[model samples]
Target chain A: MAVFTRGFGGHHPEADRPLPPGQHLTADFPVLSAGPTPNVDAARWELTVRTESGAEHRWDWAGLQAMPAEDVTVDIHCVTRWSKHDTRWRGVPVDAFFEDVETAADFVVAHSYGGYTTNVPLDDLLDGRAWVAYEYEGDPLEPVHGGPVRLLVPHLYFWKSAKWLRGLTLHEHDEPGFWEQNGYHLYGDPWSEQRYS
Target chain B: MNTWHVAQVVAVGRLTSTARTLTLAVPGFAGAVAGQHVDLRLTAPDGYQAVRSYSLARVGRDEVVELAVDRVDDGEVSTYLVDVAEVGDRMEVRGPLGGFFVWHPDDVGPVQLVAGGSGVVPLAAMVRARATSGSPAPFRLLCSVRSPADAFWADELSAPDGVATTWVYTREAPPGVTRPVGRLSAADVDAHVIPPGERARVFVCGPTGFVESAAALLLDAGHDPARIRTERFGGT
Candidate 1:
């Protein structure tokens, strides 16, 4: 595959800040439970989709593996004002992620472990930059940072791309996440500089 | 936002078994305006690095850039700062960063700081700089901790003289402390923020719930949302 210069998670020749803090905070969080460790049992994993028409469906790991994969390296801007530029990850294709689903609705909410969720407009997920990420830093992802499967949406704030993602729930309305519902901006773009409510 | 200067750790000492203060000196480290912070990035043995932002416990000249960090139970960088980091360690440092939570020498509003747990660091720095600069802004501090044992900077925060301070404890209480015994209530937010009036720029910093909940309480009690600023340590 040909390499691009300005890709997200790609190498930045000039910006010499500290690297991304990696898979997990070197320390654990006392408040939340530990993350799940992925094993060799592919049957244990299931990807679900909730169509905007109220139809729900589930896909097993074997079904997702049959699809194509894409690599992405995008600058990640956190709502907390820290921006990590040029990080790389490889993932399942967006088309493949939605292949079995009835429709790539106009709105989607990513649901994941820890009761974490983030919503985005349906158009952005298929706007040629989204994917179902499975590898990070060119290796099988570790569970702590949402290994095996995750949705990559570089256009919105990082939180909108849920980690340890289990399914996609399409909706007609935009549903905010834990932070967004609590007064954070609706569309969180780094360049737009939307840091707070 | 990407600008930075390499700083050297001139001094590192333990505040407690689980907490330490690392003081770094940048030859011309832009002086912090009280409420600002320094982002310390530490490179681990594996060539990977971690970044953490700590509020300047003290600001101004005469010494190096100093930050007081406690060992959080499950924090990645916090543990390293408390356990493994040492004196004379050189790392890439950035700031006197952050603008919203800044306290310049000229800022003379009736400044009030509401902080919880380690949230005291930035507020402590604000108070320290104010005391040192003699800003005389009618500053008051409402520092809340789990108990006296967990208070990050109990001494500097509640200095009995010119600057009025209140200590709010949510859990256990000691005898004769003369401070509130429970979490900050709407009544507490109203009392501290109302009389201070519109002129006071209320600075709120802490964990997510503490700051968000307290900010809500303050806003509910008639404080302007614009005047009330907040800073959160983690991605709460």
Candidate 2:
């Protein structure tokens, strides 16, 4: 039988924005990762987009910087149940990186420098939905927070925002990444509270 | 497995003024390796629920699971677990989660454990597992806390059982201790932990800042970045 603890009225403060189901507001951003932080120097950093056709689109750090960047302010939610509101970031949109690339694939698996991977739908990366964020709060992102660059997909659970992002491979079929292979939900959607598989 | 299992609080014990241990009877819990954590869910009578991830303090292939919780100021789930929950209380847990941070008994290497405040919980599990499994792996623990009173598992950690343990008190130190009371420094990390030459696999856990600084210190000390794992909790 399911039991509730007595005298355990949950302590959720009223928020201006409605939080996702089962999520609470956290002023402090929690860092959750499987292994050690990978320190990638911006000078040597590169991002690759490989399509199912075996074509590769590559960008060096300077090339990425040459692309137009956008200033974004969005809320990010973690599957661990903490949500931070109004987090600001600056990055080149994923669409900008794909403006000239050709891909009939519908799925993307982001690969990180530390051998971490997370899968997302290609549609989620388009339409100004995601970016390769390099700055947080107007400062160069710290390595612990996935600096020099990390994937930013604010609409999904934060784990989908793979840290120390290095590359993205387009897939004809959806493939589970690190956390997804373990227990996390694939195509994590915060609104639906799809945290676990 | 992602499925939630019903866990009944089978035992409770105070570890410190702000921390406590909860032993839960989880049916079908195959067991977790050292350093794995479980997401605990507590529901209220009104159907309100809160979930928080906690590192396992005890690991084995048994139905019993133990967790240590440190009460964070204004933390709802932590407050309930640390101060309100009792024997016979029930909650939901999904784990044994986390594959990368775990330590298997058969793994060969010296282990370096760095913890800040309540981060010691999971490392303590590793020490216990080492003792129980008769693993000869040399284990070194460097625990940084606010003061002697704030140290969790004080009694067990004070007595060394094959593990070399050192305490760095940030605020106040107990009498007769030579180390100055201050935040952990690279010097402490060098003196207490396994040196980089030994290639010890390091695990660091605690608040974000502590883990970051400690990991930086390890890097500066020439430890391989890939060998050092970290788990940072939200808070100062």
Candidate 3:
């Protein structure tokens, strides 16, 4: 048996700064998904916000690009330990998309290609907290990395940012997403370590 | 309640220059199945903590579990487990996690395992379980690595058994191998793996890119998407 004499691996100098509990600073982005990556054609890509009463608000690739887009830099945390700080994204804010719409639903279920689904509170998606981002670091998102478009909800765990996002289904009640249904917490807050139900 | 449990390192063995295998004596271990993984937590003296998940390379009778960790450059927890943590060190762990991506001895038909790099850990556990349980089910493993030196469990996997082992070297092959160094082509997969008509249950584990390619190849080869189970690690 090899005896380890060195102490716990040296800490990052940035360890003193506030970070989500159980997370470590990582310069590399780790890609994790439950299934195969869906290749969505940009021309056919569309994002729809369907209300409970059967109202559909749709945005095609051109329409979404024509909307007001904002560049955001924010810290993103994953349920997994890696945390990448100051990620730059360009997209249409959720508030701008919903500004003219009226919805009585309290929860939103994000639907993605390849049958992935996750639910978020209506409040979390509003107030400039979330975006339907199509670009990362100024390049069009790659397909394997959820290109064309993806939901970016910075306040919650990265899983909340559904990849290959196709539509948002507004619901009157809360429902767990793919991971949430599989033992993850309904509301994943990295700081609170709400990883599991 | 999936809370952290204390695990003491009982032994350590180097598998490769960048990888080490740790044997842990986890008190109250509930006997994890093959292909399941555990989350290990390391806390610094200054109160900072890091957590990472590693597949159980081997599961023993209560109180014992093994994990093979490959140190990723700039990886916080992998560096600790593979290089720093010594025998007798204690760490917090939560697991036997993941019900999917597991194989049971009693499962019907042949089992096909496709692994890339260090993703062989959990599949190795399944191989061990099949041998220990004395199941006669046919098993095949198609592993992709950079070289013979990078492959883990060479001795055990090479042992003659119902499990047919094949290696696809992306960079370098063993001394006398005639095959060129390259990725697993469609022809290689079709020739080495069990045909889809045999109704083999396929489990592929690796980084996202490897898994995506492998699963797509399997689908292209006519395997039912429902029968192919995949588990991806976070890497290029």
Who wins the DockQ comparison?
Answer: 2
lDDT by residue (tens digit), candidate 2, A62-174 = 99889999999999999888899999999999999888788889999999998999999999999999999999999999888899999999999999999998999999999
Give the clashing pairs for model 3. none
lDDT of 3 by residue, A1-197 (tens): 22222367555546546888777777767787766666689999998888888888998999998999999998999887778888899999998778766889999999998778999998999999999999998999877668889999988999999999999988999988888887788999888988788
Instruction: Score each candidate by Cα lDDT.
Output: 0.66, 0.89, 0.84
DockQ of 3: 0.30
* Cα lDDT of model 3 by residue, B5-39, tens digit: 78889999999889999998877777688988888
Question: Is candidate 2 or 3 superior in lDDT?
Answer: 2
Error of 1 at B67 (Å): 0.3
Tens-place lDDT per residue, model 2, B185-208, is 988987999999999999999988
Off by over 4 Å in 2: A52-54
Q: Write the per-residue lDDT of candidate 1 for residues A1-197, one digit (tens) a residue.
A: 11111111211224455423322222111111111122323457777888888787877777777767667787665644355566688877566566567764577888875455777777777746788887878887655456567777876667676777788889877777655674456667656655345
CAPRI-style class, candidate 2: medium
Residue B213's lDDT in candidate 3: 93
Give the lDDT of residue B196 in candidate 2: 97
Measured by TM-score, the strongest candidate is: 2
TM-score of each: 0.58, 0.92, 0.90
